[model samples]
Target: MRAVVLETAGPAPHLRDAVLPDPQPAPDEALLRVTACGFSHHDALIMEGTLRRGVTLPRVPGHEVTGVVCGVGDGVPASLIGTEAVVVPGDIGHRRDGGFAEMLTAPVASLVPLPQGMAATGGALLASPIGVALRALEACGVAGGETLVVTGASGGVGAHAAQAAHAMGASVIGITGSPEKAQRLEGKPWLDAVLLDDEPWEEVVAALTGDMGADVALDTTGTSLGRLAAAMRHGGRIALVGQTSPDAAPFAPAEAIFRELTLVGSLGVERRHVERALSLVAGGQVTPLVHEELPLSVESVTRAYRAVKRREVLGRVVLRPVGF
Candidate 1:
C-alpha cells in the first residue's frame, strides 16, 4: 500500500511516497484500514528536531487515527472486523509506521470503538489531544466553581481542556494569540471569557476573574507567558502540557516555592484517560475541535506539516484516507 514516508527531519518534514510491505498484526493486534488521522503540532516539533526522541527516520508520523477493522491477529476477537474504531497513537507512532497509510496495525487494547454518531475525524482526535485534556484536568484536581485558565485555548488540546474543565463545573478562561480565536471562544458556554496573549496578561486576568487569580492554569502553549504564572492565585496548581513557544523558560523556583504552587508536567494519556475521553465524546458531553481535513496523500501530508509549522490553523487537522 502507498504511505507518506518522512525521508528526513529538518526545519520541515520531507514527505514522500513508497510502496512497502503490508503490516502484519501481532496476536493481540488488529489491522485497521485507516479512514482518518489527526495531524498534530507536535508532529512539526518532531520534524524540526526540537522535540527529540521516539521518532525514527523514513517514518510515517501520525498517531491520532480512526478506521475500520479489516483483520485481527490470533487470539483477537473476530467480532471487531468491520467495526469502526479509533486508533490510539501509542508510543508506536514514533517507533513504527503510523496512520499516514492505507493500513496500520495497533494492539486491540489501543483501539476504542467509535461512538454511535462520532465521525471518523472526530474519533481520531479523541485518542490523543482529548485524552491529554482529561489527564490535565485530573492532574490539576479542578473542581466546580473554581476558575481555570487554558492557554492555547483554540488548539486541539486546549479547546478540549476548556470544554472538559467546564463539564467538570469549573469556569474556564481561554487564552489565545489571535483575535479570531478570542472571538471564537467568547460567549461560548464552556468559556467564561477569552483573552488575547497580546494584551497585558495581568489586566486580562484581573478583568476576567474580578482581580483574583485563577484557581488553576493549564499551559498548553509552552511559552514563557510569565503572565500565566502571575495570573495564578497562591497555592493554585498549574499543569504544563506543551511547549508551543520556543523561548519558554522554567518556572521561577522562588515564586513556586513561596506561593506554594504545584507545577506538574503531563505526558501522553494512560489507557484509562483515553477511555474517559472516548466516553465523553460518546456521551456527547464534549466535541472534538477539528479545523480542516486533507486527503491522505504524500502531498497533503507535507502541506499539513508546513501549515502546522507556520501556526496557520486552529484545532485539529485531519487527513482522510478514504474520501469523506
Candidate 2:
C-alpha cells in the first residue's frame, strides 16, 4: 500500500510517500480499496499542529473516504465483496491511519453502500459535511413555507444545508461574504435570495420575511450566532454547526430568553443521516459541489492540503487513487 504519512506535526508538517504492507481488516472490519478521498480543513489543522489533542503521530490523515469493499473479515457478510461503499471516516483520519492511501480498513457498520454507478467522488463528501448539514437542518426543524437562513451559504456544509432546506419546501436565504459567491448561490433554483455578509443581514431577513423573521437558521460560519438570533422569529430554532471563527460570538442571553429561541449545537452525524444524504446525492436531489479532482500522490496530496489551508478551493477537493 502506498500512503502519505505525516511523521511529525509542526507549523510546517512534512509529507512523504511510503510503501507499506496492505492493511488487513479486523474481525468486524472491511478492507477498502480507496477510490476517492476529500481534503478537509481538519486535515490542514492537524498539519499545522493547531489540533493535536489525542492525535497519534506518523499518521495518514484523510477521513472523507469512498471506495470499494475488497475483503471482509470475520463477522462480515461476504456479499459485500466487490460492492462500492463509502466509509464514515470515524476518527480514522484523525486518531488512526486513514484513507490517504491505496487501501484502508473501516468497521463494516461504518460503510455505506453506494447506489450503482454513483461517482465515489460524491460519496466521499456525503458522510461528513453533507451529513452534518442534514443534521443541522433537522435540528432547526425547517418546515414547508418557512424562511430558512443559511449562514456561510457558499461553503460546503452551508450549501448542502440550503439545498436540503429548500427541498423541504422552505424559502432559503444564503449569506456569503463574496458577491461572486453569492451570485453563484443565487443562480441555484433552491435559493430564494442571497445576502452579502457585510450587508445588514438581519434587516434583509426581516424584510424578506415580512418583518416576521426567519423560521430557522443554520450558522455554518460560527460567528453569526448573534446575527442568526436577531434575524430569527420568536421561538425559532438556530443550529450551530461550525467553528470557523477563532473566537465565540457574543451572545445575548436576555434576548434569547425573551424570544424563547432554541439554540442547538450540532456535531458529528449519525449513520442514518449519512444514508439519507447519500440517497439524496444518488437521486440527484442535491449535488455536492466538487472543486477539483487530483490523482493521489505525494505532490497532489500536499497541494490539496495547501489549497484547503488557504481556503482558496471551493467545494470539496477530491483525490483519486492511481488506478482510478
Candidate 3:
C-alpha cells in the first residue's frame, strides 16, 4: 500500500508518500481498496498543528473516503466483497490510518453502501460534510415557506446546506464574499437571492422576506453570527457549524433575549444523517461539487493540501487513488 504520512506537524508541514504492507481487517472490520479520497480545510488545520487535540503524528489525514470492499473479517458479510462503499469520516482520519493509502480497514458498522450511479469522489464528500449540513439543517428546523440564510454558501458545507434547504421547500438566500460567488448562487435554483457578505444583511433579509426576516440561518462562517441573528425574525433559529473566522461575532445578550432567538451548535453528523445526505445525492436533489480532482501521488497530494490550506478552490477537492 502507498500512503501519505504526516510524520510531524508545524507551520510548514510536509506529507510524504510511503510504501507499506496492506492493512488487515479486524474481526468486525472490512478492508477496502481505496477508490477516491477527498481533502478538507480541517485537514490543513490538522497538518498546521493548530487543531491538534485528537490528531496523532505519523497519520494519514483524510476522512472523506470511498472504496470497494476487497476483504472482510469474520462476522462480516462476505457478500460485501466487490461492493462500493463509503466510510463515514470520524475518528478514522483523526486518530487512525485513513484513506490516503491504497487500502484501509474500517469497522463494518461504519461503512455505508454507496448508491449506484454516484461518482466515487462525490460519494467520498457525501460521506462527511454533506451529513454535517443535514445535521445543521435539522438543528435550525427549516421548513416550507420559511426563509433560510446561509453564509459562505460557495464552500462545501454551505453549498450542500443551501441545496438541502431549498429541496425541503424553504426559500434560501446565500451570502458570499465575492461577486463571482454571488452571481453564481443567484443563478442556482436552490437560492432565491444572493447577497455580498459586506452588504447590510439585516436590511437585505428584511426586504427579501417582506420585512419579516429569515426564519432560519445557517452560519457557515462563524464570524457572521451577529449579523445573521440580526437578519432573523424574532424566535428564529441559528445553526452554527464552522469557526473559520478569527474574530467572534458581536451580538448583544439583550438581542437574543428580546428576539427569543434559538441558537444551536451543530458539531458533527450521525449515521442517520449520512444516510439522508447520500439519499439526496442519489435522488439528484443535491450535487457534491468538486473543484478539482488530482491523481493520488506525492506531488498531487502536496498541491491538493496547498489548495485547501489557501482556500483557493470553490468547493471540495478530491484525489483518485485507484487508477493513480
Best by TM-score: 3
lDDT of each: 0.83, 0.84, 0.85
> For model 2, how does the per-residue alpha-carbon lDDT over 196-254 read when each residue is reduced to its tens digit?
98889899999999999988889987787887888888898988887665798877887
Candidate 3 lDDT over 18-38, as tens digits, reads 898889998999999988998
TM-scores, all models, native as reference:
0.95, 0.94, 0.95
Candidate 3 global TM-score: 0.95
Task: Identify the runs in model 1 with alpha carbons over 4 angstroms from their true place.
Answer: none
Q: Please report how far candidate 3 places residue 176 from its true position, in Å.
A: 1.0
Best-to-worst TM-score order: 3, 1, 2
- For candidate 3, the 10 contiguous residues with the lowest summed lDDT are 307-316
Judging by lDDT, tell me the better candidate of 1 and 3: 3
Off by over 4 Å in 3: none
- Candidate 1 lDDT, tens digit per residue, 69-106? 99999999899999988866777568888888889999
